[model samples]
Target: MKEAGATRTMKRAVNIRIESKQAEQTQTQQAKGELYEKNGAYYLRYAEPDGEMGQTTATVKWDETHIKVIRHGDVQSDLTFRSGVRTTGGFTLPQGRLEMEMYTHGIDRKLNEGLGSLAWSYDMYTGGAHVGRIRLRLMIEEDRSE
Candidate 1:
């Protein structure tokens, strides 16, 4: 790991494929973004459409034990995922912030040299009621076009 005051971040244009499955519905979204490494962790930074909220910036960082997703701009959040752990995180919307929690049951990752995939499955809850089981998968690769 680098020192606390020293950090290295390499910005690389990358093509990403994100797939999420909730209940019987599955949504897939793709975008081009930058993937970087800093403080001994890998992070993916991207922009996503947010309907009336315009564009939302998303940053996903992960290590061996946990994964964190953060959003800024219109909609903001910081959600953490870990195996056998329930993490509390909510969404900040235009109207108000809605509190939510998620219990992660499975997490798997295999990344090498800034190119690979990672996945996780969890159950989401709102107001202490079970919403649905969500499975998310991400595939990342270095952009060859540079």
Candidate 2:
């Protein structure tokens, strides 16, 4: 019984990791170009090698511990993607938030386009909660020119 319980717990943990990775991949494929905010709108621009360009709009929600964003637009051909990140570790001091950013580009599978990067940060709290905020960013650019 004890072994079975441990196995169940491990399975759940593995499932969470798989889900998180899937979410991260979805975000990476859908995020492209530069991010900007104007007035009350958030905008992103994506350019394809076929001379096609796209723009997206969405809202971002931020709290002391997490940041959630939802964007919708015709940034790609017949495809739409959504992504988010949440903090699991670290101390929450001074009420900080986690931020995640991702970017992607389509390129030929045999060539290199120099379009992959990731950035993450954690903000530690001053209180005794032993909690902190986590942030992650990822970008990928592919060469679509054949």
Candidate 3:
């Protein structure tokens, strides 16, 4: 099988569902979030339940087989991930929940060759505090020449 090539950019939107465990959190905390991509860098805005907000930026790199996410922040919890077209090392955040559903093309051949679509859930904790959790589902499809 032939490996796929990376596109210049990827665009996706996720619908967030508030779990029972997270319903009691502050609405300002949820509303104070932003996602932006510019010049190959990604930016994320996070708000804490206590009404504190912070921002993090990362450089996104991708190939046919994997993705590399490097973050710039004072804390290591700055790096995070979502499912791409192929298998990837996902991410964890400092607070709240992030869920992603990914769709790809021409991955069945890779599965037959012992490389399978990647799926995972990550929960990041600091001390006894439930920092955050992320869930991702990846889907693969075939590319169309037409």
Best by TM-score: 1
Ranking by TM-score: 1, 3, 2
lDDT of 3 by residue, 50-127 (tens): 322234443333233433335444222223333434222323456643433222222112321112233344444443
Over 11-119, each residue of candidate 2 has an lDDT whose tens digit, in order, gives: 0100000011332242223433443333322223333322232344433322222233444443311211222332232211234433322222211111112123323
Go through the candidates in order and give the C-alpha RMSD of each one to the true structure.
3.5, 19.4, 11.8
Candidate 3's C-alpha runs over 4 A off are 6-56, 62-67, 73-120, 128-130, 136-146
The residue pairs in collision within model 1 are none
**Candidate 1 lDDT tens digits, 53-107:** 4679999988667899999998898899999999999889999998899999998
Q: Order candidates by lDDT, high to low.
A: 1, 3, 2
In model 3, how large is the Cα lDDT of residue 25? 46
Residue 29 miss distance in model 1 (angstroms): 0.9
How many residue pairs clash in each candidate at the backbone level? Answer: 0, 12, 4
Query: What is the Cα-based lDDT of residue 95 in candidate 1?
Result: 90
Winner on lDDT between 2 and 3 is 3
Compute the lDDT of residue 108 as modeled in candidate 3. 19
